[model samples]
Target: MKILVINGPNINMLGIREPEIYGRETYDDLIAYIKEETKLLNIKVSFYQSNHEGNLVDKIQESYGKYDGIVINPAAYTHTSVALLDVVKAVGIPTVEVHISDPDSRDEFRKISYIRQACVTTIKGKGFKGYIEAIEYLVKHHS
Candidate 1:
């Protein structure tokens, strides 16, 4: 199975930005963890991270026929970007939206998600484990 993992905005600042909520793991650590997990599952996974919304939309658009499914953590864009949602919807790939921190439990602004409607499932509050769950879900469901 092939899966595209996309993270946006401040995600690259995971360890430094807010160690309390995002944990003390660096972005590279997160990548390594995901790589290790996917290796065991024998799933081909590609990763992308951009602080720009257009770049993210472009990546999602580009995944259309190349990937079996997508695991996305749109970060700040989750609550604001309709373009991201449109592209994900347009791509029509089975997608799982992941959040390291639970939005519903945070500030009101974090609670609104424009991309959720386009995703097959949304996983939250599970930290880095959320990404693993998303990958597993897509691999199991993407036939």
Candidate 2:
């Protein structure tokens, strides 16, 4: 199986952005972990992180037919990007939303997720392991 992992907004600043809330692991570390995990499952995955919402949306839209499923961490855009949601819906690809921190336990603004409703599942609060978890879950549940 093949998967596209898209990270949006401040995600490029992973380890440096906010250590307390987002954790100390870098996005590259998370990608390495996902790569290892997917290798074990015999799955292929492509990862991309962007601070631009439109670029992320493009990535999601481009995944249609090119990927079997999508795993995304839209960062701050998760609560704000209707464009991303539209692309996800239009692509009709299986998707999983991931977050390093549990937004529900944070400020109210961080708690709202416009993308969750459009995903197959949401994984949060597990740090970088969240991505690994999402990949595993998405692959398992895909027919």
- Among the numbered candidates, top lDDT falls to 1
lDDT of 2 by residue, 33-103 (tens): 78877787888899898999888888888788899989999989988988888889899999999988898
lDDT of 1 by residue, 1-143 (tens): 89999999999998999788889998999999999877889878999999999999999989989999999999999999999999999999999999999999989999999999999999999998999999999888885
Scanning candidate 2 in windows of ten residues, the lowest lDDT window is 33-42
Give the clash count for model 2.
0
Say which candidate scores most in TM-score: 1
Q: TM-scores for all candidates?
A: 0.98, 0.95
